[model samples]
Target: PAAAADEPGTPQGPRAPLHGAAGRPAAPPAGAQPAAVTRTEIIDRAKTWVAAKVPYSMTAYWSDGYRQDCSGFVSMAWKLPANEWTGSLATVADRITKEELAPGDILLFHNASDPQEGSHVVIFGGWTDGTHTAYTAYEQTPPHTRRLDTPYAYWNNSAKYLPYRYKGVTAGKASTAGAGETVPEAAGPASHGVAGYPGRAMFGPGADNPYVTRLGRQLVRKGFGTHYTKGPGPRWGEADRRGVQAFQRAQGWRGGAADGHPGPETWRRLFS
Candidate 1:
């Protein structure tokens, strides 16, 4: 699993179940198409991802064959010809202030000196509180699509979030910025961001969390498991552990390392 700005660090080892949402939110309604998507459509597309509960992939994983990273997800929402990293994407937008943020605007986190190492972007879904300390947002993160409230990594520090709006996105005028251009469907992950799963602190056996469920889905997707006849829930059971070990074995890991417990190295490979 590649590290994204949303994640804090790797889990030391498997542990007891933690309390929280499964790091995923349900998708918004597909709704009726308007012949084409509008700026509102861009935001709606992002919401749809939340409803679908698409899993995150540091290698810029694709869901329904569309790239799914913070930037890639934004690109998909903006309907760009190709996926673009946050830096390049920022080039096309006009910088704005926090007070100017609105639906469809982007919240960016980038260090101009080293954009690739620690950068993230999210779609503004509006403020959640009166003081605006927290807000609703749409983002692609490790584990899956998120409909999140603020106090998140990229949003905590006012200095971290640089607000921006696409040039074509006007406040009172209709625009085609979200209509997007067509490009060849490409393979491979985006070249920006850390290359590993950086969602939770750790994923241990018997740990029923969204991270575990995410791992289970990835394992099944990669042909490592058939343990779940129904669906992979947020639980680290024998089947989930077995799938991890299988993936390790397939990667040629030896002895204890392949014993089914995921370490940083294992996560890197799994996410990559």
Candidate 2:
């Protein structure tokens, strides 16, 4: 028999049954309407597994009752009315462009001819830099759930991974600023003591400057400090990237706008 579509590697022995809320099968009810969700909520749901370090298994289910695999991770994150697999996921989502990629969207590579080979799906967290050559990917693979800085599309099968957006997603109340738009001056207390946004060159890989420190401190002040394990120092690190990404997502920014590298708009809102 072919391997499960979501399992990329050779199948392992069945995992010990999960011990928590009773296990539920990974099947959605007939005719269920997926609840409306926001981009922020989807990313938040995806992080729950990362926090719990949920193990991956095609046959197992998590306490919250989703299958413990790549597709199931996405089903839970999208808050779909029921579980979905690689084949069925697209029925509920629309194919999107790479430029349209945003937090909560997915980069899916499903193999219909052979379900196992390298078929998989990952939640698009945000871009790691302006180049769009890499991004933050949240996935459930062997060992556990992980948030990684992945190459465009994926490390393997780069050409096959296509971007998708869930049809039921709705933009939340926060205002979004697109790329190249002039970021208005912050209107409230957030503007106080906030320095102007330095050029983009001040941050990203190999950037070591006081502005990086300032950005890190402001991120911590704005409740995104958890990404930092130690100093929000002058040097840029994964923590800084993740912290900035979280702040950008909070503002309803997506795609290039939320690339973790702070643009002028991201700066205005973070300080605001």
Candidate 3:
């Protein structure tokens, strides 16, 4: 593939892979890890783990859990709660569901009081019959898989929820589940190039990275026009952040909320 070239005017340049920017084949995301064990199996095992260990507040740099907050449980289910950048369980719940939903989608429920009590979440691990079961890491509640239907409080209350479906879950791409389990559709990531810019430079400090281009793509989705161009730029800095912030403002994210600092909320909404 890399070695093959064009024959005369055969339009023979190396096209980037679909996974990369502008079809520019990107190296697979770095530091990526194989998902630990079969998800449901893990959840089933987690119940025993929760029973033995004491529940502590989540204190990872990415999470605000004094120990095992609702969002923290989801983060741990995906093994990335440490990837947190905000204190809002809403923010965490929003990000996980920002993608699509499958067997491993993380679910969240919130309250207004105790972290463990107010914010409760579960990791979707497929269904046992028509019932939904989840694996969660909590102290007050025993860790393990649970079915919230019959006696489990029948979840889905007024509290908002989001499910994060990890890529490459079923097959190499994505798949749809049958019946009972509710599957979410994808919000198209900016797969094609936008007006003006069309290279791997849109994600730089001023412009660079597929993730940054994603930011611009989000602006476009929210009904904003690109003031500049497209493609991955150089680095993600001021001008970039400003562009993002401006887009957020246009989206009516106010009250110092969407400050363009570019954290989880920004990515969740943008990537959503």
lDDT of 2 at 107: 92
lDDT of each: 0.57, 0.73, 0.37
Q: Which of the two, 2 or 3, has more lDDT?
A: 2
Candidate 1 similarity to native, TM-score: 0.48
**True-vs-predicted CA distance for residue 66, candidate 3, Å:** 10
Question: Model 3, residue 110: what's the lDDT?
Answer: 43
**lDDT score for candidate 3 against the true structure:** 0.37
Candidate 1 stretches with Cα past 4 Å from truth are 1-6, 9-37, 60-65, 152-158, 170-272
In model 3, which regions exceed 4 Å deviation?
1-48, 51-53, 56-67, 81-101, 110-117, 131-159, 167-272
If both were scored by lDDT, which would come out higher, candidate 1 or candidate 3? 1
User: How would you encode candidate 1's per-residue C-alpha lDDT over 197-243 as one tens digit per residue?
Assistant: 43222243214457777778888888887766657777555576678
Q: Poorest 10 consecutive residues of model 3 by lDDT?
A: 6-15
Ranking by TM-score: 2, 1, 3
Q: Write the per-residue lDDT of candidate 2 for residues 1-272, one digit (tens) a residue.
A: 13322334623222122234654444445566667886756776787799799999887778886778888888889987566778778888999999888778999888878767677889998776667898888998987898877788887788999999999888651122223343233322232233576555456544567999999999989999898888688877688878988888888877656657676667878877
Query: Residue 78 lDDT in model 3?
Result: 45
If the candidates were sorted by their lDDT against the true structure, best first, what order would they fall in? Answer: 2, 1, 3
lDDT of 1 at 128: 46
Candidate that would win on TM-score:
2
